[model samples]
Target: MKEWWRGAVVYQIYPRSFLDTSGDGTGDLPGIIQKLDYIANLGVDAVWLSPFFPSPMRDFGYDVANYCDVDPLFGSLEDFDALVSQAHALSLKIIIDQVYSHTSDQHEWFMTSKMSHDNEKSDWYVWADPQPDGTPPNNWQSVFGGPAWTWDNRRRQYYLHNFLSSQPDLNLHNEDVQDALLNVARFWLDRGVDGFRLDALNFGMHDETLRNNPPRQHFETEPTRPFDFQEHAYNLSHPELPVFLERLRSLLDQYQNERFTVAEIVGPEPLQEMKDYTKGSNRLSAGYSFDYLYADDLSADLVRNVSADWSDAGDSGWPAWAFSNHDAPRVNSRWGGENADAETAKLFAMLSLALRGTVFLYQGEELGLPQAEIPFDRLQDPEAIENWPETLGRDGARSPMPWTENDHYAGFSTVDPWLPIDMRHYALAVDLQQRDEKSVLSFVRDLIAFRKSSDALKTGSLVFLDTPDDVLAFTRGTDEGQVFCIFNLGRTQANLDLPLCTQTEIKFSNRSAKTSVLPETIPAMTGYWL
Candidate 1:
């Protein structure tokens, strides 16, 4: 089988905001099908759709109610089949989000387990008796807020939930549960999914002893939730996670196609966890963290640190990189700051594509969309609402995609969308950029094409080059060819003596000085590939 995912570019689509063919104020599978050509035109190798299964909307589709079917809100099983067929016709591989750690309370497994202690499925979910004083099993806190355990009157025991109470964690220690989850994967594999983005894979299991987490040393200010007060040593990231991952990979091997899996790992020290998860061929294909997604600034030191870690991650380990996604603020607003413009956006595109791994490009990122300003009344994300004013909620990044400026709701839908479209996004609409030669959209298309055409940029090794304080420079190469990638990640222009070589072709650049000889100065937020 061909490992097509190696250094491939995957486009992430949050179905709720991509396009709404259905007039029910929400985007659906048909909507994604309608935009398949638009996605293919961007030159991405695959399209990863966020969860579309039946969900109660508490945590959106992360709380899966059915493992094998699509939600009526999105479409039906037939709609999904049509989507897969259309996506394949465009030569776009389909990767779906798989929330394995938790499921909605409405799930049949949870319903049967909650009915009685003697039920056939009683041990499917994580359940424990209260303490002597009827308190929660431990001091663990949910990612949202409050205690991680919620009491159930029917079962007369507290069930574990690392997130919202409605989303209960599964008992991954149970071999039965593991078998059931693997079957769910088989069902999707039969349906033609090329890969899965495993959501919170580390949270699938817990300490059987139910031990309290140790307190963390003071580093930053007060945290958004009590969950951050500790190192999360006992409540999550159990030693058994790697074992489960091995079993998942074995299941993928059962199929003839070269199926892939990328785990979404988030912990205090995710770099080591990422390495452990992808240590060998028996484990995951790749993994990513909140590294750059939540970063306050993009700097030379940060890139060098991450690059060094992955370089030391051993031969079989692979890394997947992303700068923005549905859960975090846009890069233009995060790193670009107030002075962000078309130039900065173009530079970021070059930098991300030049990295040494598979890259994920989120919706609206190609247009250089900044974070939207959503009012308190317009907020829909539970985490944002609970920690408002303190954190810039994710809803701003998940707003409807602006397709055209003249149409109502920016051509996303005829009726109002679940989340309002950002007014500023109208000027950067796809239709407008399609006509402008120098738009961010056009620059991204050109960058992707350049990366695809160059063996050095697509599947080469990386070596960090010694450069100035504000400049991030690296050389990507193979025995056949090599090229230098340099970016001025600062707000002011940087002047430096760049390393040079023969056959120094200028493959791509933004506001850059085009020359075979090294340019003495690079403009602020500019990037060049040589």
Candidate 2:
């Protein structure tokens, strides 16, 4: 099978906010089908839709109630078929989100499992007897907040949940459970999904022994929740995860098309974990971590260090990089800070695309959208709400996409949206950017086109060049050709002496620059491709 995801660019869509054709203050599958042309025009290889399964809205759609069916709020399975048809018509692959670690408490499986200690599905979920003092079995903590174990009165035992209490963790140690999850993947593959974005793949299997996580080795920074206080080695990133991934790969092999799988890994030390998850053909196609998601600044060292970690990850191990996503603040706010500008966004685009990995671009990232200032009352994310005053929450990055300047809800819906649209984003609407010759949206489109055309930028090997702290320089070389990717990440202009020959051509640049620089000063927040 051909590895189409070698360096493919994936556009992520948060369905609830992408578009609302249902007029029910929420986006649906039909709405996504309506925008297939726009997504295809962005030049992305695939569209990764966030969870739209039948969820109870606890952790958005991450808490899945039914694995094989679509939720009414997002439309039916036929609506999803229409979406797949339209996307394939546009030559775009569809990668749906898969949440296998846990399920909504209301799910039929969980509902049955929690009934009694002798039920047919009793061993389907992680349940254990409480300690002598009636406390949880271990020191694990939930990702959202509070304890990882919730007491179930029906069984007189505690059910484990790495997230909300409503989301009970599945017992993958059971072969029956594994088979069921694999069947879910098969169902989606039969329904025409090209790939899957596995949510919290590391959390799929936990330490069956239920060992308490040791205290964090280094903790200079203030811990947000109890989850950050421990090393999370025992409860997450279990050693048996690769075995399960192999099973998933075997199931996907039954399909005729070259389908792919990407795992979303989060841990204190994620580089090694990411490598393990995508180590070989039997594992995931790629893996991404929170490396650049919550970063406060984009420094040369940060880029160099991350690039070095994945540079030697063997041929079979592919890295997936993303600077922004639905669960984190926008890169414009985190990296650009108070001086968020189009140039900064452009620089980020250039650097990310130039990396040696697959690319995942979140929705609204092409528009250079700033983080929305969602008030506390409007916050819907459980994590953001739990850590409000200390953190800015993820709701800011998940506001409705601004398609028009003055249309109702920025052309996302005729009625009000589930999440309030940021009124200030009107200036950066998609239609407005389409008219501007030098808009960030246009720059993103151009970057995607260039990346798709260039063998070096797409699937080349990355080699870093030593430069000043404010400057990030690297070379992407493939059998076809080599290109130099240099960026000025600093706030002030910095002079650099080029190490290239005078005959070097300036292939692409956010700003015009000399190819052969004896002493050329790079402007702030600018990038060049030579």
Candidate 3:
């Protein structure tokens, strides 16, 4: 079977903001079905839907109450089946988000586990007795804030929660817990999901000894939360995680058709962790880190350094890249700053596409949507709400996807959207961009098409060429052919000498002119594939 995910582009749909057909002021599975043609037309190979599982909505859909069922807020199991069938018909694979690290406090397993100390499921969750001082077991902190251990009076023990107190960490070390999660994966596989984007997979297991996390020796900047004050050594990235991944990989192999898994690895040593998690076929197919998503700058040096790190991993490792997602601020605003424009958006699209690996494109990214200016009063993300005034919060990146320009709600909903649609997004709505050939949406479509036609861009090896600062030059080559990719990732024009031949031709370029001869100087935010 072909490794369909290698070099494929996966469109990420944050279902809550995608489209709403049920008129409940929330996006649902039916709405995704309605937009299938739009996504297929973009030339992407797959669509990765964020969690739609049954949840109490405390951490949105990440706090899973039932892994095997879809949340009624999104739709029913039948609705998901229809989505899979429709997406398959359109030649687009379906990859659903799976949160295995933790479950909502309301989950039946947690409920049963908390009822007593010796129940059949009592050991399914991470529970420990309080210290002599009646405090949390260790100095570990929650990513959301506060202590990582939450006191549970029913069991007279504290439960571990790497995220919200409402989300209790699962005891992945237990064989039964691992088997149960595998069964959950099998349920979705039987339902015809092509793959999974494992959410926070590195946090699946913790140090069984419950040792305190040592404090960081240096501060990059002022720490935002207590979680940042210490090195996340004991709380996550347990070595036992790869053992569970082997079990998952084995389960996925039971099916006849090829199945894929990509882990979201974020912690103190994310780059190494990403490589470790994906080092062998017995584990995950690929793993992505927050290297680019949270970056404050996008320069040639940064891209070169990151690409070099991945390249060093060799054939045994596969990497996934995403510039923007539900968790981070939009790339245009984060990297391009206050004066981001169409050219800036196209530059990023070209860069991400030219890189060697699978790419995950967030919804609204093709249209170059900037981060929404969400007010504190209207914010819905708990993380943002908790760290407001200090941070912009994730709500800005997760606003409703604008479809029509004229609609008051941007056609995301009949009434008000769960999150406010950025008024500026109206100008860049899909309908308006569909009519303009020069729009960012159109450029992205053509770019994706260009990538689909080039085997060198898809699965070939990447080699960086020496160039002046602010200018990134590289070549992606395979047995079929080689293509030289160059980009000016700066505000000023850059001059460089290129060795070109009469046979050399421009494969694609963000610049308007299509010429065989290479220019001595390229304008800022310009890129070319030749």
Candidate 4:
């Protein structure tokens, strides 16, 4: 019943790779149940378990067939209930993913909808009559590198899919589809789930007019598609979508605690879109975009820009921050070199917590694990299947969570893992480092405790310090006082002219890396909060 997501730390668990109790090389509810303690120990407030619904697994569970039931690969309804009980028992809220934007073509609704053009289930999905040339209904291209529309031979029409051809986009424009999604939410809410992580929520609505997206003008930039080429003014972020978000909020509010919904909007214009989705009190509680996840650099100016972007987002809405997720390469890989060390990773984790918003921590991020160097033959992600050299795919970031050293599969499973266990991560495993005073894991614990005790870091205003590049300085403040936080984002020991923030207490340090600010010198690659 508590609205605790504000400034909360959410631990994202990709169910398939977190553990493999079934020994089928994929993780399941029992595996998650066994590892609830690991999640609880991380000091996160909640766990956003990625989709485990009835799925065809073509997209590795993103293509949902049934929203209300657990897939056999994961477990049964009773298994989910047990997982929920275990999480709550550990004082952790459970937020499951809701893939409402599309469903596996195998879904009953899609099956029925594809049977006949005027069938009762027709219009539940985004379908259109083929052009006179019998090509796709529109110029829209699938995100996986082809036509977004797949011709349904039975109905003699083309169905829309933002992703693969096997996953058909739902027509949220249809009132019945909206009702059906809400019913799915109701099913989970009644089952005692805390919230829903709306996958590609902005993609729920498309332009009813079926207008063709404009051409890409910038040739120097990456190639554009129907997906990324246009401003997407009409195809997505439709004015009608928020009405449904409000409806979703209205339904969630019926339960004692209004359940949270965080939309995943990926594009060049995500900041504005995030704001739009969480604009009014009636819509979603928070929205997290892919700014940090996709960024290759972590400059101080970039941090300041994000903070200023949402300085006045208001209580009706808030920003949720995540540096990495399944879709992204680990920050360590994106921001590599000496700066990718454990200490720097610890600092980033602390800085994320100190920011005035909710933080979503990927599985191995707390341990400072970089992207796994997955070989070409061992890859399992569809993205990798499509584009290998240019992209490492999500599997590189999802190697099993290392738990112990000197054990096969890094203690993640009793059998072979879906992906090879990174032996280099063994030294950073939980069992090995829990006792160390200087471990990233320990720093995370200390930082989470600090966040819990400090009002400034929890629900306060953040002002970026006028510090130089490579050295990020910010003051998190409540009416109680100010907490000064600084991070040396670079490798070399750089000196900066400190303005007003001269006298400061060291609240926490992620690294002993040195630095010099006008008069006094600090350690390199270190982070400090006062």
Instruction: For model 4, give the 10-residue run with minimal summed lDDT.
Output: 513-522
TM-score of each: 0.98, 0.97, 0.98, 0.95
Measured on C-alpha atoms, candidate 2 has an lDDT of: 0.88
What is the TM-score of candidate 2? 0.97
Residue 310, model 2, lDDT:
77
Off by over 4 Å in 4: 219-221, 224-227, 313-316, 513-519, 522-524
Clashes per candidate, residues 3 or more apart or on different chains: 0, 0, 0, 6
lDDT of each residue in 174-235, candidate 3, tens digit only: 99999899999999999999999999998999999999999998998999999999998998
Alpha-carbon RMSD to native, per candidate = 1.5, 1.6, 1.3, 2.3
Q: Which pairs, if any, clash in model 4?
A: 513-523, 513-524, 513-525, 514-523, 514-524, 515-522
Higher-scoring candidate on lDDT, 1 or 4: 1
CA lDDT of 194 in candidate 4? 95
Q: What is the C-alpha lDDT of each candidate?
A: 0.89, 0.88, 0.91, 0.82
Candidate 3, superposed: residue stretches over 4 Å from native: 312-316, 501-503, 514-516
What residue pairs are clashing in model 3?
none
What tens digits encode model 4's per-residue C-alpha lDDT throughout 354-381? 8888889988888889888888889888
Error of model 3, residue 337, in angstroms:
1.1
Q: Per-residue lDDT for 1-530 in model 1, tens only?
A: 44888888999999989988889778899999998999999999999999999989788899999989999999999999999999999999999999999999999999999999988899999899999999999999999999999999998999999999999999999999999999999899999999999999889999999999989897577777888898888777888889988999998998876887998988876778888998878999997757789788899999998777777335748889999999999999999888788888888899999998889999999999999989999999999999988999999999999999998899999999999988899999999999998899998998888788777877788998778899998899888888798888887889877547324666677774557545677777888888
lDDT of 2 by residue, 1-530 (tens): 44888889999999999999989989888889988999999999999999999999888899999999999999999999999988998999999999989999999999999899998999999999999999999999998889999999999999999999999999998989999999999999999999999998878888888898999877867888999889887888888778888999998988987898988888866778888888867778888757898687788988888777777545547889999999888998899887787877887888888998899999999998999999888889888888988998888989999999979789999998888988779889999999987898998999899899988888888888767889988889878889888888888999887657224666667764555432377888888887
Error of 1 at 230 (Å): 1.1
